[model samples]
Target: MTTSHETSLPTCELGPGGPIVSRLALGTMTFGVETDESVARRQLDEFVEAGGTFVDTADVYGDGASEEIIGRWAAARGGVDDLIVATKGRFAPPAGSHGASRRSIHRSVDRSLRRLGLDAIDVYFVHGWDDFTPIEETLDALTSLVRAGKIHHIAWSNVTGWQLQRIITTATLGDFVPPVAVQPQYNLIDRGIELEVLPCCLEAGLGIAPWSPLGGGWLTGKYDRGQRPTGNTRLGDDPERGVEAYDVRNTERTWRILDEVMSIADEHSRSPGHVAIAWLLSRPGVASVLLGARTAEQLNDNLAAADLVLSDAELGRLTSVSATHLPPYPYGMIEDFCDVDVWKRLGTASSA
Candidate 1:
């Protein structure tokens, strides 16, 4: 496997737009919530200097404060044309919204544009699928935006395989602009997407941009088995976000796997976070991994993953320890049919 560090950071075109972006995108979920304006500005400057053009934010992130911060940085930097900004809607304030209704979609994009200080968004995503609203209506609204120049491309986040497929089918039939990318929760510990969401993206020709690539800092080996992180840690400060990280089953397994990751990092003289991010970049269909950092030191360490390449032997060992079990039925059946040996020997040699 080729490490991102061994060569220049990869670039991919955003949908049909001409703007090119680095393979590693900076996520701004913690921009305003965990990090203040000064720290956020420093991180943004470092990222731009590192050749990272892709910036991901959401309308609901810190109630739009994240987008505002990013907008300020972009304006101050005076290179808005060179950046590929991607922000999501449908997760706006007042909390617990169902789906992307026409009114909500319009309002959300207008608010996002105001917060971003831009005339249009480079790429926009439906934060999550809405079961209550008709999928066609949502696609129609998004397509209208594309036609009106409000957004350049459409994308999806936190959607299931079936939902993604349905949206694609609707767009194709309606001649709407199909989604060009997907954002999902994917990492060593959260491999559920491998069974469905990933395959759907591959089949549809949509790029995969995974969020929480470090498993919300779990893969960095920061939290102990029984010790809870407090204060600044996302898990400690946010009760709602902490539940997933604090799961007993997941905590035990994450620590166990961290032992293996630590060994690999030690061999390469890198931090565990670097190794963890590298492992995600090694996976198939991973166009980029979204990483969030509160401090410049943390950001620098995470950025080094762009240069850290794991040898084939190291990748194999990490895979063995971190691979999760597939549930019975179609998934198990598919795994049995598409064995690893057959995959490497006869399957298509595409970058995962």
Candidate 2:
């Protein structure tokens, strides 16, 4: 593994005809919580200077303080139109009605706009599928919002592949405002979405804005192998995190993944987290990677990945080492069915 690498960030369309945004996005989940407003502002400034244009936040984050900070910053920076502001709805908590109903969405969007001081949002996410609210009702509400100029585009997070396909199909058939993107947990360790969500997005023209590109700081190499996580780190501070993470991720599989990442990091002379982020940026269907940090230093360090375009060999090396195959059944059978003999037999039979 070699450690020397350099890459540059660039803008791409969020989806088909959607807004063009930076390859890397800033996630403000820690604002007003682990990171105070002052430090959060500094992090935002540094990120924008480093070519980041997409900023993501949820209404539930920091009890709306995150959006407030973003609003204040946008006010000073000459309004929200300059940046591609993305915010989420749903999960109202104490207010109840935690679904994408007409009432829920209207309330969420109004509150988000008030907090962010914006009239229209760039990408408005549903946060998650609201089973409590009929999908049709949710779609209708989103379409109304678009027509009313309240939201520029609609998006969804934490949804399944079938669910997303249905939503896109229904929207298109009804001429409603279609969802242009999806935000799912994606990283070296969490590839479950690759099975369905990634494929659906590829065909449906939905952009993939992957969250947890750092795997909750696991890919940062802060946790040592075979040792209890110690110190003030995210997982170190919470002992239960290790037990939960180690349940499926603590095996030769992860060790190999970490080892290869460290090797690549050494070759590039960057942090393992940087290498991880670079690998994710190269993945298909990834419009932007959501990078979050508790401090400006972490944000700067993660931003280094923007310029790293992994070599073919490096890409192959990481893919082979870190890839996890899905269990037997549909995925296994589908791959196994693709064979020279089977292809010839099927072709002959069809021709006959």
Candidate 3:
């Protein structure tokens, strides 16, 4: 019953079982935190039914509740072999035990395996860089885990371009397995990574999975310009932090841009969230957009992004409004003089 569209889309290989998955991956951050177990399971089922096999989660999410929920769903769904399970480690628990130390890494992986009920994780990510720890020590530990058959592949998240490059160089020197993917906070509102991280990822042949694809729901158009999100799950749980992240006062320009994006979505008969994610998928070197949905409806809407193609004019409009103004110097110089003709030849001008 697979449609031609689903059958023909390219996949990005993570490890052993298969090569490339459906371009969109379901982020499980809200699975066990904002949403209940039943709702999480239903969303998981719908994602699989839509031919989505890439599922992302992290140990620190909801204090391991995310992994537990995904584990239980995988057990019940009956197709564990076909799924690509990517989980991250290295985030300190609420109790404050966090690092890339060998001891901590091993303990984290073992605990994650128990929570996930999986023998080996498909792709295990270092949730964040540990400035206190040596990169070699961390990479070596990850390499050992891969050799031990506890992890199929290693990846990274919340790391800088320099950190990834150094790790790659160290791995090459040591003849260890390099990271295959990188999970970073990327969206229209937060294009900071575009300055350097994206370029490094593309050069390294590492697939990029963008988290906060909706800008922490800022791009969803649910929060009003003057009013606060009273009942929104993330906002309600942490008012102060939410106020800072979702404050419309500080985001007036972003909201103005969102208004235009909303108009485009309305014209296309699509949700703004779908259009937001669609824009990410249209970018270069974006292997997958990690969408965290609180409900099955939201997940279904996001899945539709894979099929939504934004026109050149639409992309141009969005880019003009959402472009991040980088600091001056080499970056600004490059921005000003970067050859548009070269990108046009490569067909990446629209995405730039």
Candidate 4:
């Protein structure tokens, strides 16, 4: 059933026929880590007050304290009956080799439900692809939970393009319920998902709820060229680790993207993070965007992106600058053909 609140945020179906969820979701990865329980509760209350219902958490975050904090908050705020609490499993907790076995799913869901103080979870995601276990086995386990009503929906996260397609196809042909959503690292700086993973999810009708919408805080305009971040921020405390994390995205190309984002933000009088998220929300096949905030104040600031709409030109500028230049064999060549005058009239893949 749809959690009825009638908030101003645009709503979308979680999947083909799943429950109603806000287009923007609150991510609690930092619940008990970067943010304490008191602040975590404040963030939760702020999110709900701002019309957000779909919350993304994981069993492994903060060594499971994230879910625990959310659990307490849900209980105190009139119970979890009206909230769509989404969490993930698959990463073993300290001692196991890996998870996602039938036994693991069974145990994980039970523990999650217990912690969340609910009889069932709104959505349960496999944290990552378990190479040790067969995809069929994982699907069977997830479907069993669905059959038992332990989880309302099953989701996938951090899976490759082929892995996502394989699982969806396997489920369809094997007569198991398909995944309702796929979570991946997506942002203006990380458009790698657009080449294959995105098209696959779109083709299969699965919802895309991208995490790290701010590009690991890179798009927030905090990092500087050749300068180490030094603060209580995500990268500031450990400059070495910050540089290592920054190594991947500290590029001339990324700087150009950041410049454009800042320009657009200035035009609209918004934060760079807000512009980045607003750009992400305007993408196609995106049912929801996960905003990971470190504090309630930051969460409230980012929430304004939900209402900030960019002009078509501004959206196209970001898209054009960040467009993926895929390999020439299939994607690039096919897109080239689509640009032909004749094929253009017939409609191209992107226009679909």
Candidate 5:
């Protein structure tokens, strides 16, 4: 169901028969962490007020406080009947059990439902590929949830090209429910998925909802070059927190990308983050971009990216500046032989 009030942002189907969601999704990863319940509620209200209908969270986020906060917000507002709510599991499993096991998934989904105050989840994602469990076991468990009306659709996150393909193939062969989408870390700074994960999604008709679209605040133009962060920002608190660690991404290439992004933002009179998001939306398979904001103010600023459209030339320039290098062995050789252009089409082909 769509939101009661029409949204200002454009919408699209997440995949074939998937939910029609806003181009920007509200990510509640910081709901119970940096953001208190009152601030989190304001964020939710403002997100819905701006016409956002998709909300993404995870069980491991704040040890399930994120989902609980969202649940309370929904309860206060009557319900989330008009929104498409998605959450992930497979990160915090049951005692002594590995993630993605049948028992683990079953328990995770039930607890998620209880926390989210929903009879059924709109989309359920497996947080990452679990090496200890067979893909078949995971699919079987998700299929059971779908059959029991616990989840409407299934998706996978943080999988490689081969892992994603294997999930789809196993679901098809085993006659289980196929995934409608795949979530990956995609942005101007990290087009690593363009090599394989993206091509597989495009071929398999799976929609892509990219997390960390701002490259964990690197693309926000807040951090300075050569100077270590020292404020209240994500990196300021912990520079080596995750994938966008300052030392890892403070290279010449990242600076170049930021320079281009800043230039484009000045051209459009928008924030560097908006330019970064608009560029991601222009990519082939992105159904929505997740905004991981800690406050309503930040979310409002990020949501404004929905209206910032870059021209083809501007898009090309950003793409050129941040292109990822394709590997040599099979990818480069195959493209050379079969007249099959892979990353080239994505504007991600660099010197191999």
Candidate 6:
């Protein structure tokens, strides 16, 4: 049995030996947007009191208001010296420039430092891949930040397999500070990253901090089939909102996966979300799973998953049911004639 405030969750290194963070990281994307400061502060306090140490946020979240909220929280608590604070800076670039350009990155880092009330960011992530800027240019700017002590470790998010490989190649050749981690959206309903991105990260020895592990609330079992959400839910407010829109995710496959998750939850007497998150934690190369919530209660509910380890049979069932078919071109071709077991390499079913 666990105490009220003690999560008793394990820890993992972000990179091989980079900053050690709690297995479940608190994501502050809802700060100052869906949630006010007081609630946000409560969530942060709850997270830390429950043994969470990594807090992730981005400069564009709430148009920098999220960082400001976190900054105030840290100020009230004296400082986040014990926490591994991470923030991204590839969304809001300077005027007339791309987000990943040298000028934009330099400006973004300074602003993030000021907003977070920290001398140096613990883990600074480039929010996404920027085609407009060369990978070398971005790597150079990040290397300079490391030297100046403005940032400690570097990471990337929302990149493809080719892009990530290129970044690693460029940084290795140029002697730049390589990324310690890569953040991608990985969940049962969205296992697209397993195709190439996951393999690349595993090979490069980069930690994967996965976002949207609950498939934007689909894996939570809160939404029903054939019924449109109509409340204060993420889809209710705007069914056609972002990637997790109602219509987009309301498919047969989604319901099948959700049913399996609910079955596992019932067996464990836990929330469906607990099953979803537990499954992610069982995967390889998963350093931390980012948990985003709109309220303290939601965050607390998510924290319970730390203690819920799924059985091998249950995990295999979920993985099998949610497995996607691989494309026909290269992945399928290689598996067919080359005697190379792509399915074993992927650790999942070949079908996408």
Best by TM-score: 5
Under the 3 Å rule for N, CA and C atoms, how many clashes does model 1 have?
A: 4
Model 5 segments beyond 4 Å from truth? 1-5
What is candidate 6's lDDT per residue for 10-41, written digit by digit as tens?
88889755798999999999999999999999
Error of 3 at 298 (Å): 1.6
What lDDT does the true structure give each of the candidates? 0.79, 0.82, 0.78, 0.82, 0.92, 0.91
Badly placed stretches (over 4 Å) of model 3 are 1-10, 14-19, 93-98, 236-239, 242-244, 334-352
Candidate 6 yields a Cα-based lDDT of 0.91
In candidate 3, what are the lDDT values of residues 1-352, reduced to their tens digit? 1123453333555422223666888899887778899999998888888888788998988999999988888788664788788899887532444489777888899999999999999899999889777888888889999999999888899888898898878988988888888888888777778767877776777888888888877788877776767785565455456323555334667787789779889989998988898888877677778878889998888888778889988987787677765556565556468853423322223332
Put down candidate 4 lDDT per residue, 122-236, tens digits, no spaces: 8889999888889888899889889988888998999898999999999999898789999888888887787678778777888889998997788889999877677777777
Q: After best superposition, candidate 2 residue 41: deviation in angstroms?
A: 0.3
Residue pairs with backbone overlap in model 1: 5-307, 283-352, 284-352, 285-352
- Cα RMSD of all models vs. native, in order, equals 4.1, 5.9, 3.8, 3.6, 1.8, 2.7
TM-score of each: 0.89, 0.91, 0.88, 0.92, 0.97, 0.96
Worst 10 residues of 1 by lDDT: 342-351
On the 0 to 100 scale, the lDDT of residue 179 in model 2 is 88
User: Which pairs in model 6 have colliding backbones?
Assistant: 324-351, 324-352, 325-351, 325-352, 326-351, 326-352
> lDDT tens digits, residues 62-159, model 1?
88899999888878877488778999988663345454988788889999999999999988999999878899889999999999999988999999
Name the candidate that leads on lDDT: 5
Superposed by TM-score, candidate 6 places the C-alpha of residue 77 at a distance from the truth, in angstroms, of 0.6
Candidate order by decreasing TM-score: 5, 6, 4, 2, 1, 3
Better of 2 and 5 by lDDT: 5
Model 4: lDDT equals 0.82
326, model 5: CA deviation in Å?
1.1
Candidate 5 structure quality by residue, lDDT tens digits, 70-89: 99999999999999999999
